[model samples]
Target: MNSDCVFCSLLRDEGAADWIWRGQGASALLPLEDGRLAPGHTLVIADQHAVGVQDVSPAALTQVILLVQQVSVALRDAFGARGVNVLNASGPDSDQSVDHLHFHVVPRWAADGLDTWPGGRSGHRLGTQWPAELRRAVTARQL
Candidate 1:
């Protein structure tokens, strides 16, 4: 574990907030923030330290996402949230505040005033011109 990472410290020390769940590959808990960003705002983090998605094994990432799904359901039931927003900031240029990989599961409701995505925008863009080999490489690879 990285001695400098707060998440690592939280896990290793064991005096952190109440854990929602914990298992072989992932753990869930309320974020250690000044206050909840939204009702039932929780974090699902990989048990092993990894800076981003690319840094983790597929099995580990799968475990984390599965836990996120479970926690989202729990939030929906416990908080009566209409829906939830599963967010991850995976890289240096991303809005990730912590180095360790984690996903924010924020409960949402109508007019929650939480603009997780940019508002006042009509549409978004996707790159049509792309590297054909990128698709080929992924599809051709064996597990």
Candidate 2:
């Protein structure tokens, strides 16, 4: 485990945080940030100290995905969210503040006022602007 990682400490003391759910290899904790995004925004994280998705073991990655899905479903059921956004920032360039691998399950409503798009005025739509080759390169099949 990374001694400097805050998530590792959180996992060690699960009760210290606002945990929505905790599984053997992963857990869903309530967002520490101000709840501007959504009421049930959660951080689904691996218990192990994986710096990024590429560093995670297959079993650990599976557990984190399972927890993320579970938290997303719960957000929909409990908070009346129409949709959910599953997001992960892997490295520094991706705006990952923490080194530990974590997924944000942000519940979405019609008028949540959060800009899901990172490119504010690029006028880029997902399937429209992305080149076919670039899309293929980033697609889940490559992973």
Top-scoring candidate (lDDT)? 1
Residue 86 error for model 1, in Å? 0.6
Scored against the true structure, residue 111 in model 1 reaches a CA lDDT of 90
TM-score of 1: 0.83
| Model 1 residue 115 distance off true place after TM-score fit, in angstroms | 1.0
Following a full C-alpha superposition, what root-mean-square deviation does model 2 have from the true structure? 4.5
Top-TM-score structure, candidate number: 1
Query: What Cα-based lDDT does every candidate model obtain?
Result: 0.84, 0.83
Q: Give candidate 1's error at residue 5 in angstroms.
A: 1.3
How many residue pairs clash per model? Answer: 0, 0
